[model samples]
Target: MGLFTRLDRASVLYNGMADRLGVGETQRIDQPAGAAAYRSALLRCSACAEAEACAGWQMEHARADAAPGYCRNRGALAALRVE
Candidate 1:
């Protein structure tokens, strides 16, 4: 894939996972720490190898309690979810 397409895929995965985990709302409530964690999660997503599977999974599920096992950002996303 081209550079832009690859970057877009990564962005989609990061944003989709963030939304699924309510990271934006969390960041709004806990600015510094939440934003830092979310950014770190996004960085991890950008380097992940499961983009195709991640996209398919995100499309199939509107929300999930935890990210798929193959996701590089799974731990970060799961931790960010509100209890």
Candidate 2:
């Protein structure tokens, strides 16, 4: 994929994972730290090798508490998830 396409795909994957984990909700409640973590997780997702798998998984599952093992940002996103 081209640069923009890759970035778009990455953003979609990151948003899907974050939404499933409630990261956006957490960031809204705790702006600074949560936003920082979310941004970091997106950056990691942008460099991940499994963006396509992540997308497929998100589409298949209505909800998920954690990202797949192949996700580089899995741990970080999990930590940011709202309880």
**Cα-based lDDT for every prediction:** 0.73, 0.74
Model 2 C-alpha lDDT per residue in residues 3-75, reported as the tens digit of each score: 6777677778887777877777646337567666656666677787877688888989778878888988777
TM-score of the candidate numbered 1? 0.71
Instruction: State the lDDT of candidate 1 residue by residue for 7-80, as single tens digits.
Output: 67777788887787666655533745766665666667777788878889989988777888898877766666
Off by over 4 Å in 2: 25-39
Pairs with backbone N, CA or C atoms under 3 Å apart (clashes), candidate 2: none
RMSD of each: 2.8, 2.5
Superposed by TM-score, candidate 1 places the C-alpha of residue 56 at a distance from the truth, in angstroms, of 0.4
TM-score of each: 0.71, 0.76
Clash pairs of candidate 1?
Answer: none
Q: What's the lDDT for residue 69 in model 2?
A: 87
